[model samples]
Target: MYSSVDTIWTLLGAVLVFFMQAGFAMVETGFTRAKNAGNIIMKNLMDFSLGSLVYWILGFGLMFGATNGGFIGTPDFFVTGDYSSSIPSAALFIFQTVFCATAATIVSGAMAERTKFISYCIYSILLSAIIYPISGHWIWGGGWLSDLGFHDFAGSTAVHMVGGVSAFIGAKILGPRIGKYTKDGKVRAIPGHSLTLGALGVFILWFAWFGFNGGSTVSATGDDVLVSMASIFVTTNLAAAAAAVTTMIITWVRYKKPDVSMTLNGALGGLVAITAGCDAVSPVGAVLIGIISGFLLVASIEFIDKVLKVDDPVGAVGVHGVCGAAGTILTGVFAIDGGLLYGGGFSFLGVQILGVIAVIAWVAVTMTIVFSIINSTIGLRVSREEELAGLDIVEHGLESSYADFMPLISSEAATTTSTNDTNDTIPVKRVNSNPNAKMTKIVVITKQSKFERLKEALDKIGITGITVTQVLGCGMQKGNTEYYRGAPLETNLLPKVKVEIVVCKIPVSTVIDTVKKALYTGNIGDGKIFVYDVENVVKIRTGEEGYDALQDEAEAPSFA
Candidate 1:
């Protein structure tokens, strides 16, 4: 009777966990470029379908079938056994299958915007059917680790760790986004499209997690069951809250401002950290674990980005891998000993470390081999042309910004860029009121000292007015590199300032002359100047004519 009650509640929980695929899809697409939204959604759909179907065929039995002396289950391929009709059998397969698929989806976000659709599909199936199940068998399948009393009450190690590590490896193979790391080695902040969508997806995931941790208990009645569920809920919530605060505060202190995306990742870091021992840990323990996990996540992300030179676009490694390992280890410390709260010592802590090492080895080695095979045999990346054009139009032949392109918005991005280009081409609608149409205007990218010489050259050409902006970027000259985590992040370029000069239509050639003279400090990468045709201009403050408005700004921007 007790087993029957537990089984029913768990199956219900599986259903909730199953629905979380939608949340993952929305979050991944929202966080990446709109051009790749369709592709992202497609990968997610396939991951679950492929992961579950594969798991059902042979993965499930290996994970939880009758075991050989508690090291691993055997003879349960396709779930062929006398226990097939048992309640625990079906409930176990359903719950574990969801977790396997969830792990596979984590990679989708980290390697998004660049990975080939075929590669993603192939990896997704491998992760669920092969990667997730093998590790799951070790810990939860009554494998050797289970015999050693290794505990992962929820799947911090089995699901999150396996997924996170795979993501980290995959990201390394895929390389950074086209302009993410500049040629000079400076890391640039590439903001996601919508913060609102990212945040909303996080909230939905939080709601679904209750089912994930609660259903693991497999019971509706019993004091122990209730205690575990309530404890896990508290721990989960605390960890998420801790992570958000920790990231916000760290970023505020380091950058003098809170970074929203870091905070979002922080929340997830907290969740992954507590999953291993949520049921066993005390509420106070949860807070401490959560706080540490939150801080670890921020550090880990920076490390991975700067030091490891791994471009995890969405930071799945910090939120899942590091936090997962930390949580699983913490479980041994807190639950085994007095948990620092009940006076628990470091004995369990040692056990936790051992478990983490084993799991890491299993995942790292297997995934490396599998992915390397795919990389060597079939290319893993798409052509650079396809990436720059946006995956939607190139791959799917659909534009994500259909509305902006079709209906049109007066002040929208595309329109603004188009208007600027058109105005440049139709330049010289009328001669400058001042008869000096020969003044050459050059937009020079250089320093203040170097700029003055260009001004002198412009003076010779009768060029007038210049714009200077203090900016930082790379331009083929090697820039200073900063380390994030243990990776060497290299942009491999140099930084320079840009100077703009405007002259009469005739003197445009002179402006170029002045810039070339003033610039060129005999350095590898001093700067460059380019001229473009002028177009109609407008002054917001007053209805001013052409030259006056043109004088305000002279350079045409190459919109990225």
Candidate 2:
């Protein structure tokens, strides 16, 4: 007899899990450059699409079929074999399918930006169809780990760690993005374009996690089931919150400010850490697990980026692989019944440790083979030209993901200039020359915030025309020393605005005095002014020269 409540709960969980694909898409896109945004979106979409189909064809059987020597499952293609469960077979299959997709999707973030689209697609198929299922059998199915009393309530190891390990291996083999490191081994910070989108994705993932952890119960009718679901929700939330807070404090002290991106990753780390033990651990245990995860997230990211020199755009390996394994092992120390701290000797903890190691070994070796094969044959990464041009343009033919907001210029107009010069000649209008009216050019290099005030001051002093350009430079200061992902960054160039003005009438002293009065802040970065003698000025529209060109048609020349 199937319970409708259990069936509904399982399906609902599957839907929530499915929505995590969007979260992954948003997070990956936001953390990368806008040029690669479309490519990231496509990869996330295809991984889930391909993962779902492949999981149904061969993955389901290999994961849930009859056991074979406690290592693998009997091949039950198309989910044809009868499986005992409280919910319908279809419901259970769909739920597990989404879980399989989650693991496969995690790799895209680690290998983002430079990966070949076809190569990534091939890798996704292999992970979803073979690598994930084989190890999944060992834990979720009646494989050796499950037989030895290994417990992973909601795939901290099976789903998250598997993805994290694959991400590490893939990123390692694929190599770092261009310009990620200097010749002297100094790490360069390639910040994500938008934290707003990353934050939105994090919130979405956090919201859907309720189904991820709670829905694992696969039941809601019985009292024990209801209680377990509530506990899972509470533990899941507490862990994420605790981890976010811990990371904020650590980054605040280390980076001298709360790092938004790292702090967000901390929340994710907490969620991944508590996932394995949400049902078995107490609320207090969840909090402790979250704190540990927070520390591990920051440390792992720093180690991987600086020492190991692996480029992970979104910190997937730290939040998923490291924290996943940590959470699973910690479960043995926190579980109410068999936890070591709860008086259940080291036996259960030993098994937990063994499980994490075995899974890591399994994913590492297999994914290495998969990536190596892909690399040796069709190639795993894009060409230098293609990468520099961005995957969206070369791979997908997309000019830009945010095309509407950009200026509209056709290819022909952008690339080619007409050779015809029929209308190039303009009629010249010579005015009376004033030999004493010397043209002077004034250039102002100042803080960007001071541009408006300086412009107003110039306008009040009868200096109407000026051009401004945003530029980067440094003087005696040589910029500030900052930390990014725990690495010291010596900023040699700072942003500033350059204002240029040419006048044949207004005295240069008058303009200089007005600028100094408006911009004097007595600060280190106040700015500098440069004055130069201009030979002449010309108005292209009217072909007017010298002082006549500098004056607007409606205004009389002050020089006259």
Candidate 3:
């Protein structure tokens, strides 16, 4: 029997973790395009469902009962073969289910804006069913690694590290979002749609982590459970505070202003770094862990983006992979009982290192093969045309938003276009075909709600366009109204995005359909769409036109 309070808390924590699906969805969507919002939400939701079922049926036995088998579990699947009742198996399911989801969401951030929901759905099943569980079994199960006296109080190695590696593999296989990398190999800093939402999502995840780390204690018997929960709470907050401050200062010094996204990642990095030792270390130690983790996280994101040429859109690898590994190793050195830093010894560190190495090896090898197979067999990226347009319209055939960018407005005049009423002449940006052109450019103007699906729909067909600008205004209609500050502002023009679909006209209809379907918002504010006919395209390489223009012109939705 268990204490009701413990059970309640555990269940409450599980609920919070479940809500993290929403948090991740918001963060991923905010960081990427609005068109991919539904796709992201779909992926996050399915990830948890698939993760729970798979973890329940397949992962649980391998993780808990197989704790003796040194390599893999021979005991159970469906959690029945060695079913002996000593604990509330349901609680284990709740806690570990969150972990499986966490590992699954890690891939979401890495593969956002481009992955087909179906492909991603299949991968999610594999991740929860096979990838995360097997890696978890190696350390948390009575596997060879656990018997070596490895210590991961939480899941620095088992959950975060494993997820990180999987994320890396998925990202590599998916390639960067269309605009993430340039022809010249320059990394562009693409801003998220909603910084506030992204930041808020991070805070929500931070709050839910109390359940995440605290619920790790499966038994309610030990005072260590309470003590561990308290320690985790204190250290978790401190590390995040330190990380935010560190990242804020670093950004101010380096980039002239504090960046919200980096600060968010820094906070998460701190949490990740301290996760391995939250139970064993003091709050002060947690602060140190966060400070260093913040630095490392920021630095690693840059390194991965530049040196390794990996595109981690949401910094998933840096926050989880690099920091998770760092946290695990630090625990061996900082653990108070016998750490070298506290005059303990190097044995703990060595064990941690071995554990880290084993976890990394397993995840990297497994995910590489899995993703490679998926890519080779089922189609991975959409056709270049579809990519350029957007996945929403292409995959699901529905536009998510109608906000379109007014082509002629200056940056400062962006907000003013709503009031100015003009019906005759729409500000049009034309993109035509050239045999030698290097890229295709198209601007789509429609309702605010429909704008999101156009690009995604286009991308799915066969396009990977570049340099899309999201803006809001109107060309003909006097739309709704808004309250700016205290005064009521009239909403004449609705929102829209200027999709720069850069491709040869080989698959022009793919792009057009996304624009048309999503543009029909069934509202008066549902604005007009203008697809200007391209005139002349120039391919700088060969200075060619017509047939060769398309060969020279480049891809289709996102190019940094």
Number of the top-ranking candidate, with lDDT as the measure: 2
Best by TM-score: 2
In order, candidate lDDTs are 0.74, 0.91, 0.72
Alpha-carbon runs more than 4 Å astray in model 2? 82-84, 411-439, 446-466, 472-477, 490-496, 503-507, 513-527, 538-560
Runs off by more than 4 Å, candidate 1? 1-4, 69-71, 82-88, 336-344, 401-405, 408-560
Instruction: Report the lDDT tens digits of candidate 2 across residue range 1-560.
Output: 99999999999999999888888888888888899999999999999999989998999898988899988888888888777478888999999999999999999999999999999999999999999999999999899999999999999999999999999999999999998899998898877778888999999999989989988898889888899999999999999999999999999998998888899899999999999999999999999999999999999999999999999999999999999999999999999999999999999999999999999999999999999999999999999999999999999999999999877989988888887843666767777366567888889998899989998897787776778899988778765566655666555677799999887767888888889999998767788999988777767777777877777767743431
TM-score for each predicted model, relative to the true structure: 0.72, 0.89, 0.71
Q: Write the per-residue lDDT of candidate 3 for residues 195-235, one digit (tens) a residue.
A: 77787788788887776776665544467667767777888
lDDT of 1 by residue, 1-560 (tens): 23666777888889878877877777777677767778787788989988888888877876777777765566466765644332556677787788888899998899888877788888888877767876788788778777776788888998899889999888887789887776776676555556776787788788888888877776778787687678778878987787789878987777666777778778878888888898888777778788888789889988888777788877888888999999998887667344544566665666678888988988888888877877777767788999887776766667674445455446677455655445433333444454333333456676545656766776665555557776666666554443322233354433456776544443455456556666666875567777765444444444444555444443422110
For model 1, state the Cα shift of residue 69 in Å. 5.9
Q: Against the correct fold, how does model 2 do in TM-score?
A: 0.89
Q: Clashes per prediction?
A: 35, 0, 91
Better of 1 and 3 by lDDT: 1
What is the Å distance of residue 420 in model 3 from its true position?
Answer: 28
Candidate 2 collision pairs = none
